[model samples]
Target: MVDRRVHEGEAVIERAVVDGRPVDADARLALDARYGHFTALQVRARRVRGLDLHVERLQSANRELFGAELPRPEVLGAIRAVLGDDLRDASVRVYVVAGDRPRVLATAAPPTEAPTGPWSVTPVVYQRYLAHVKQAYGFQQAHIGRQVARAGFDEALLTTEDGLISEGSITNLGAFDGERLLWPDAPMLHGITMRLMERMDVPQERRPLRAADLPRLGQVFLCNSWGLMPVGRVDDVPLRQDGKLMTRLHEHYDAVSWDPLD
Candidate 1:
């Protein structure tokens, strides 16, 4: 289940500011040629949920990709500079583009709400390159996103060739076996929202969940920055949904304290 959300209106991205300054056309082209990593956050009322996690994500990704950590203050400053006090309730993304040096591009767009699913997904045999770090748009992820959209599915479920499940195209996958929650043990981004839910004291464990075992779960769900949603079906396999569990998860996630920006 790709975490890309449906905007309340057109998703218009504001001008991007790199390292606290708006870039020109040539600079924009320069950034396009470089390798980068990014993290998208939802800013609600000048605050963000999992703000520390978001920053740490950038810090760690910067270290892995650029050979040095982008300081936390600089990351915060870039966000503030780009947002320019105009974005209160909006979607803001901090991008770390690597050239001879690294640059942080902070940009904003319309805020998004989690898809209220009952979303259907089709499982495909695939794995992401450098899957741990949230690298910029990978070709395979985008390809599958388009394929599922054209194939009449809500999202694409990713599994290994041997049928061991890993994750969704963008969202983190979870399942309940009528008791404890199970997150796939395979390689995937340990998303911020997924980690927040883990702190809620839910009975959960990280383990290998197989795609062929879907029918045994009492509930199947997907989560990402937008929010959590129930899975209606995996391919042709109709899975059960627990409304009460979903309500509990959503409430806990929403109850997460927000970190103020500016």
Candidate 2:
């Protein structure tokens, strides 16, 4: 078992270990904000969905950003060490920073409740750098999210310069056209959850989705590592929260097998 302790008055408490040793709060934050690539996922009862995909994402990002290979076994061991046996349901993040000596940081905390949404989103004209890699881009994402929230929207939909809807600040956008799912044909991170949905034989298409196409789409959903959620409106246009589609997505997602943290 790993050490577990709580700081008072903290709703979400995270315990972080660097390499093999536990780190102080400042050290944890420094590593997290440094130039690194990371992946966040859910852990339930010490098991995770799409474990291999998460590992692959970390390795791919490490190789792309740092020109270094992250050994699969070591990454898994770090996650296992951080999670230890205390996992009820939690959120875990694995961070890899490049330097003369590379550092790996793993942190785990109680999972936040999934957003209950029929969310309203506003499109922002922006694109992420190295959009395929999940790097430390939290500041920009948070800024956009805050701006949308102030405008009475739940989240921000990122669009390219050509007015094509690409993705959400932290979520991947999916459209269901009554017959099939459509993913935006743009540079965006292929989320592990999205990949799992595809593996379950969810009929999907990748194409350019313009802002004008929003009204014609049958339904829209936001997805990330946590789960699938419905979207009710985009900008000023209201969308259908297709109950049948949500049910099918949840069923497919729940059917995925969970792998042990080890």
On TM-score, the leading prediction is: 1
After superposition on all CA atoms, what RMSD does each candidate show versus the true structure?
2.6, 4.9
lDDT tens digits by residue: candidate 1, 1-262 = 4343332112566667888998765676568556898887888898999999999999999888888978999989987887786767878878888776787887777778876659888888998877888877466786787788677787778888888788888888988665577899999988999888888766788888887677788888888778888888877888888888777778888899999987
TM-score against native, each model: 0.92, 0.91
**What value does the lDDT take at residue 261 in candidate 1?**
87
Show the lowest summed lDDT stretch of 10 residues, model 2.
1-10
The TM-score between candidate 1 and the true structure equals: 0.92
CA-RMSD of model 1? 2.6
lDDT of 2 by residue, 1-262 (tens): 1011111112354678888578888887677557888888888887889999999999998888888889998888888878766665778888897555678888887775456768787889989988888876367876777677778877778998888888888889988777688999999989998888886565679999976787788788888876887888888888877788788778988999999865
The local distance difference test score of model 2 is 0.78
Off by over 4 Å in 1: 1-11, 24-30
**Local distance difference test, per candidate?**
0.80, 0.78
Query: Cα miss at 136, model 2 (Å)?
Result: 1.7
